[model samples]
Target chain A: MQVLARHNVAVSGVEGAPVIVFAHGFGCDQNMWRLVVPAFEADFQVVVFDYVGAGGSDLAAYDRDKYASLAGYASDVIEIVEHLDRAPVTFVGHSVSTMIGVLASIERPELFDRLVLLGPSARYIDDGDYVGGFSSADIDELLESMDSNYLGWSHAIAPAIMGNEEQPALAAELDESFCRTDPDIARRFAAATFLADNRADLPRVSVPTLVLQCRNDAIAPLSAGQYVRDHVPGATFGQLDASGHCPHLSAPAETAAAIGEFVRA
Target chain B: MTQRLEGLPADVLCGYLEVGDDGVVTSANDEFLRIVDRPHDEVVGAVSLSSLLAVGDRIYLETHFRPTLQLHGEVREIAMELVRPDGTKVPVLVSADMALGKGGQFMRTVVFEARDRRRYEQELLRARRAAEEAEGRARRLAQTLQQTFVPALVPDIPGLEVVGAYRPAGDGSEVGGDFYDVFQLHSGEWVVAVGDVCGKGVEAAVVTTFVRQSLRALAVQWDDPSQIIRALNTAMLQHGTDRFCTLVVLRLLKEDDDWLVTISSGGHPLPLLTTADGEISEVGASGSLVGVLAQPGLADARYVVGVGDSIVIFTDGVTEARGEAGSFGLEGVLGVLEAGVTSAGDLTDNLLQQVLDFQAGEARDDIAIVSIRVQDDADEAPAPAPRADVEAKDRALRALQELQELERLDEAE
Candidate 1:
């Protein structure tokens, strides 16, 4: 199968430049990296793509059984890396994909030069002494909230696109204008993202790694960032001055500069 | 913030806040202060959006809420639970909109309590879950009923190696209306019949049961498959149900070193015959459907099962299965069988697995496959190789090797 077309992959930047692959988090598509990708275009070959079922990917290629866990998404990252046809990649994974990049690097170490985990969390649910954050009940509430929000959003967005039926081209583009997901798929993805426990896979990350933690992150606590740095050998943990889960959107300049400094170092 | 905040309900609590790009609460209305239970002076320029909720709700807000508002310019109807000052969890629907102000882009957000809507949605969720559980139970019962329709074991018929496998459609979620049975009569004749009802679920399962009963009873009295099918048609017409079944009945007789196979069909697919040299051909004749008219037009065709020759009879589910390219019709079945097999079990398993591997996902229909072989003096014959598939594999391996060599040469240079 053509994994490129299946993933709706887009490649850009100057030829022969060092390659950087950006994997977006759950709930949205590659558009989540729009603010961060352009900063590297001058000096790097940037590759941005969508995870299946979330963006303009070939929906038919999505298999529910394969994608029940994070490994399936990790496999897609490896496939994308294998098709890069250049030097080892500088992989940037946001949110859930941070763990996905870690897993992919463990499986194929030669494919990557550096690992950048944006707002990374190894485990979301708290265990005995590890405070990964959240509980089983909280995860359920998150899924329920997602369902209600998607229901209202779909109802509001559908007619606005349909009203411009005179231009079918614009309507087709507007279909994915908002990174909307089918509710059932989003629920599964949310469960996979929030319920995954990947603390054991930390020691296996052999590549040079960067853990970028936001100042006021609720999804991944400050303790979680320290845990990642302490666990992964030779990993450097840096603090971004931005808040919330996505510093790339809230503080793209700072996020990009921190990454550039680390890559150059 | 220049845009006017209007068109909201007066009674509903609407909190307003000016959020910085880094998600700090730069400004707040009295309603916002009351929602977070923080004093106006303490809240502004000091708190982030995630500071209002408990740890769990904070996670939800950070991952889902703010990212959406940042990217889409607005996030609507976000249901979040805030920890009130008195340590009570308040379920509220928060909506936020962001726009550019004088110095930087700031957001104006509103929060509304969703206690009543939450209660109504909880009731609806409970109802939906209960209905799903009941459906799961009913489907299990239908599957149990379907199991008793086919024989638990194929009777040990001497002088013939018989193997059959039945795969229900959708992995036993729905009761398949297809069934098959094999047994030896007292007069030394082996009688086998495979049939499928027109529809599915309990109703088709009922038709399958009736057809099995009629075929087993009629085959004992009459030797010819045509006569047995005619009697079955009459029985179904008299039973007076709006259901129909397609059937293929075979009578096997071992004569000398060969087995004589006589088969008749009632609007069923033709049986495939695989010879010793690994060639497949369609045998048997098509006839009128059973239970459709007063005089059923079923026809019989004679086929010989020599040593290393196998006969396969299956339901329409096998022919109608879809793959990446298209349906695996008659030609697809032949392509699978042409690889040849040593015994009945080999052919039966090979065909089922190949049909499944032809598609990336699950088979879309119920499959019933029965293959009978006339064993040689030796218990098993060596399975014949499919020339085309083996050649294809060889070519692919060679191409991979060449590609690896090219990569090595590039590295050396």
Candidate 2:
């Protein structure tokens, strides 16, 4: 399959302009950036796509061995950018995707001009002296929490949410499905996201970087974000007034404005 | 109506709470206040609903639950926990909806106590994990048992090259019935056999083990290919196995500069013979099914294969493999052979890869292939001396001829 089709890539905004790709985090699809996408549509060409197992992308494309590490996700990003034939493009990653962008930029630094890391944590589990906010038990509890919410991820619900002809009203009501994923895929993704430690890779980044840290974020603690900033050379840290792991969802206007300032500069 | 509306909080069985877009609790019913073990005044307009949840559920709310509510306008049966003032957690099922209220927009949530359900689910989860572990153990055991049926390494014959490949069907979680082995018999001949049992899993594995062991034992005592297979069939019947098998056996013996190959089949696919110029044809005769009929039809076909000739034998898994176009039949095998695969390893590897590609990398049946090729004379540069066994056999034949001549001369005198 074409990399663009494999990733379910959607490109919009001004053509022939500098590109900005938006990559969502663990729980949601590209719709996580729906509120912030319009802010850059008039000036820069915008790109948004779903990871293989998360959204409308081909579920058959999810190979367990390939996606076992962050590097596999990084390859997807590199492929998408290469397909666009637009080098030195800006990448905006949230949550686990932050490391994905970091790995991608490190591998092919020429393909990326800048990176915007939103609520990113280099590692979720605390290692020795470094504080990553949650313990290993907390991650297990988080998995259990996910298990309890399997009702939202049923395959039976996906077709209806994707726009079933028999249930037009229900389909129309949820035209923009967000945070819907296969339960098994979600469990693996959660493990990959939480168990990964990319602290050693931060210094290898060569692109201009921006770290957007949200206050009181449960998933990515402030220290984790600061660690990313401190380790990545010439990285700028911007604190958002929003409180949550997903500032782009909770406080979109502020989130977009912060990103806009960094990208334009 | 006003009085009923005011009394609904106290009358309802489940807990209810309303929070604004900012997630702070704006209103709480008496049932909710009781569930949290907090006074009504302390909860309403004082604390955020997220703060009332456990840490894991709090993360779930921000990452999954809240985004789901915002995009779909409602979320159903989300499992979460509510923390009490005493730091105890109340397991609950929450359903919330986004609605436009008198004060801009708010979320109305209903909480149902689910301690029993949570415990039940936990048990189910544990059972599922245990079953998965058991299946993993079974799969590994099956693989180990399967390795015993095939030779770890094919004995290196001086003039002949041999290669074998096997792929289990599906995700390889269950044992497949197909097996192949290349081994040297005590009679100074190489025997190659490929067979498929009637089914899969541990049951088929049992039959495969029996067949492989029987063939090895029979090959050691018997020189004729047909006789060895017939003996194996008799052994299976005597053993009273309900399963049946299809097998093809080839015995190779050095004949001067060429190798004489004897092929026999018991309801197995015919082995293909490829010439140096890529001409492909079937070599073995069609035989009856094994372990069923009292008198099974079996025959041995012989062919002399010289340098740059190959004999490819495989289970039905190869020709019967279904794809988008159709089953990869004998024509597909011939097509691959016609493409010019000169070596035994190349023939086996290419045929397996072609079959897998035909089926889109998902093998519905186990595939086993064995190929034997007589190496080209040019490839064996400095020719070595003949083997001692062959030399001894030649000397014994010459001695018998000279003794017969001497006995005839003495009788004439």
Candidate 3:
């Protein structure tokens, strides 16, 4: 009950249905999964909730100590699973949540069955020989970009990448309805997200994993996605034809079809 | 001139391609031809949309774009860079969805150039980063400067327990004018004082520094609280600084195996004194503001306090503190004191917390608190003889001292 209130947990669809928990990425809330979740509701129980400080999650529940790293958020995911008394369900995550799901699966394997990593990157910044796409300098620029462009963050990054040119309303709808983050939480989350290197935890994930490598995803690039797929043990790698970090939003039906096929398989 | 579609414009930099089941561009309009920086014939039945993207982007198409286009026949605001014929990149946003014709379902992509917008976003990002860096630097400097002037920790004195804390106000952006001191004299007496200089910023802080220095110097000359206040007044008048303050100087003296508190006030709030039986009341002398007039006569109030009893001295920042409701007035302060505290340190901390909590962790004015209590070891166990454990503890103490020194160096850096 406490965890539900804290993270604003929402459950819909058939109660006894197989559960599918959707976790949104950085600069986003559970609503980012809205485009794809409708198709899943008919078959699977859809679960969506915000991490503290994002979307409708209680901001006061955000503790800097607990939220200082990805492990903190993973605990929340595990808690939500425990809170609902459901586990070994389909866990789909986008961007940072992809690794968050990975951490949760490792910490409590009983809580998840299949892991869907959307635009997952084992590491974001370039290390010794690993090519994680963005340089440390580029990350600094991204953080600075977040700082300078308050509303333009969603406007430029969300819309530009998603190409709302056809129906600008969709981009505007996302701006008003999703990816809205508290500034302080967003900044700290940005630090935790980009600076994190979860390469070591990949091979430890014991669950069946699927990597959805979004084409032309600037934030979570192709190589990064491929790196995660290659490292994770027994992980099936499938390339999505959709462009941008959030295939779930940009190309919902195709993203879902892949998950549906994988889950059934 | 060609008639544009309802929402589509010629200057919009838009294009459409009929991508077949194999994901090859079977046909393209001239505008679509111009956007990709390729000849119409070259793209027709020859190239796929994935061919126009970077390698990393092509992988993206394999995973996300193509599948979505295949299933839903559309995608939106997909950020990708298209390679023009000249090899220069055009950073554009593309939107594509499928439309059915006589052939199988094919995808049509619309493109908008984003070079200018990207540049603007980058500039905004840079400015925001610069501003954040400046704020971080200023905070570091303020913290360092705050530490340099004030005592970082309360002085540890045996028998006489002292708890001292200072909370700076307003996000700690600027230095406050509140100052406190907890030091023991050579005469076995502890001198604890709390003061708030009028106004704020560097000027008020300068006056607070003067008061702190002058009070410490005067404590050497006299043990009487009233005389010390008078001496501070004389020194401030001689300095000719146009500043004033509210101060309370308290001397904890031991006599006849009992402790007596001699307190002098300079237009400050009276200190709270509660007995061992929970009888609480304000007890302190009164006088005009310090350092203002040439002549300042401050009275002294001496009282005997038993063991387990405490008195709390604080600045107006406590009682005058603002909360969501209103100011935590004298009544509010007394209420906190009424709920008896165990130790002097705890009492001081409790009172400080009440004010801080009242305002929900926001300190609008600088606050200083001093609580001195007598030890309650009357019915204690006898001392044990030295053992091997003592040697271990001694080594541990030395290690702790070294670690503290290292910490001090870290702070200095």
Candidate 4:
């Protein structure tokens, strides 16, 4: 299936070492793990990849029906792990990808050794008694904000953002290319991420799991993180001093330290 | 001059503010303070920039805006809304850049009121969504209209393997003018017809339906292929429409161990005949176009297709399909046949796939193909079974037959 090329998979660190696969969240690509990846390189074989419709992955492979739900994204992860031929690897996921990792691990429990969910949320919209931190109307408003900002992302910078092979240097020169995605694809991904309900799927996890919550996180609040930790069987909970949804980006030292301690233990 | 310079930041039309690394508002001009409707003392050194944003905008800041700024050193013209102390929202366009200072890294930002621009952009977004929805509805309507012109399933004709394929031009959003049908006549003979109308979209679709239905209605009454084409031409001429169509009709009748095939064309491409020995040739005689002339030249060609022989009929969409080299001419069709396909399904599939690949997967015209092969005896092998298996197989077969009968009853309704 050319899984490595399809996801733009990048592998580094020691050969034949314990593997750690990092999956990015909805807004960005594998580059989100740049700071933390360096911390794992000395001892662990670190892997990172862009999901379809993001970064340098093949856009022709994006199927609207296949990617309409989080299951489609989970299938990609399973394919990557199977294709890597590496079983029982540790998985680290951020934001919406945390739920994606959980789904994948549950579907193929033998492929994963442990799961690290950073700023995880089982649901983003508030339910009857569950406080997911945002209302349904707020998510709609977020989609609107995405639409308004798409004006700057339209044609002028799209070629560079797409990492055009003809002008590789131009794509490489743009630091913003990591988070920039095709606006239409991003809109679909946003809906699939924020509107997903995976609360019921939590207790099905059989792997050893760790939930890391960031203080003052706006997207995935502390309560949502606690809900995930409470639901997943034998899941350990930790809190980071980082003040945003992205601890790997905002506080890479502390974030990597916590993950390092857990993996080593 | 010094006093004027100090007042410049306060008097500017856009609001200016600065935030420390922790996102706390460390400084704000009078204009910035007024935009959020907060006193400078209460806003600066106390309020965080993220707290001033609406909930949705706050998420946008954390997910998109902040990441972009941290990576690119700046973010420009991001649309967001700020919540005032009284809860009124103010639409604003914000641009910010991060820089290192003596106090540590801080962000300098400029905010401009954009209520009018936001309203205009919202209108544009709504219009785009409306246009997309209308396009989706039209495409579905065309598809349903197209299905009425083309038969859904060809009846299973004994002793003959019949297969047909149709591909719409471009994205299938507009109705294509190509259609094919296979049906049984009252005389127990089978008729296969392929046609192409003059144009595309709703107008051509109307003519296509008229021509196809008229042909089917006339076929049952007449036994000769040439006579059928003639009657269809006269009916189209009297129908009072300027649109014309090209057609080829074939009549198949089982005679002893072989099938007698009769073919006629009305300004349509001739159907191809493939013998078991790998011989390929055109079958039908050329005739004048239907509906345009009072006395259109029409004639029938006859051939006996024995076991291991096949016949293929198609629209000009196949022969006239444009490719990088040129049109996929009659040679292309012969080339596919020359590849030695064994079954009716294989011939139709190979021909269509070659044409599509030749055009790099985009069909410039609608393509319709129908292939009929005289089956070899060895092709239909009976199934072997034990006593227990036979009983189970009979039960499953009875269930399938019942389901098919129910489906036919539903269609009748």
lDDT of 4: 0.84
Candidate models: Cα lDDT each: 0.77, 0.83, 0.75, 0.84
List of clashing residue pairs for candidate 4: none
Question: Candidate 3 chain B, which ten residues in sequence have the lowest lDDT sum?
Answer: B380-389
Candidate 1: what's its TM-score on chain B?
0.65
Candidate 2: residue pairs that collide: none
The TM-scores, chain A only, for the candidates as listed are 0.90, 0.91, 0.89, 0.92
Whichever of 2 and 4 has more TM-score, that candidate is 4
Per-residue lDDT tens digits for candidate 4, residues B1-413, read 45455434467788999988777899888888889999988889998898899876787677767765665566677777888989899989888888788997889999999899978977887888878876776676567656655666666666788899999989888887898888777787889999998999766877887887788799988888889999999998999989889999999998876999999999999999999999988898779888899999999988888998999999988999898999899999999999896999999999999999999999988999999999865564343232432443354344335435545755986
User: Order the candidates by TM-score, highest first — what do you get?
Assistant: 4, 2, 3, 1
Whichever of 1 and 3 has more lDDT, that candidate is 1
Stretches > 4 Å off in candidate 1: A57-72, A85-87, A125-178, A182-188, A195-204, B1-13, B30-47, B53-57, B81-83, B86-92, B114-178, B186-188, B196-201, B213-248, B261-413
- Candidate 2 regions with alpha-carbon error over 4 angstroms: A58-79, A99-110, A121-137, A147-177, A195-209, A213-216, A220-243, B1-7, B85-87, B100-104, B123-155, B165-176, B267-289, B292-302, B316-367, B380-413
* Top candidate, metric TM-score: 4
Cα error, candidate 2, residue A154 (Å): 6.2
User: How would you order the candidates by DockQ, starting with the best?
Assistant: 2, 4, 1, 3
- Ranked by lDDT from best down, the candidates are 4, 2, 1, 3
As a whole number from 0 to 100, the lDDT of residue A54 in candidate 2 is 77
Candidate 2 residue lDDT tens string, B295-367? 9999999999988889899999999999999999998999999889778999999999999999999999999
Q: Please give, for residues A1-265, the per-residue lDDT of candidate 2 as tens digits.
A: 4898988899999999999999999888898888899999999999999998977888999999888888999999999999999898999999999999999999999999999999999999999988998899878877776676554343323432464454467456443445667777887788888889999999999999999999877688899999999999999999999877788877899999999999999
How would you class the docking of model 1? acceptable
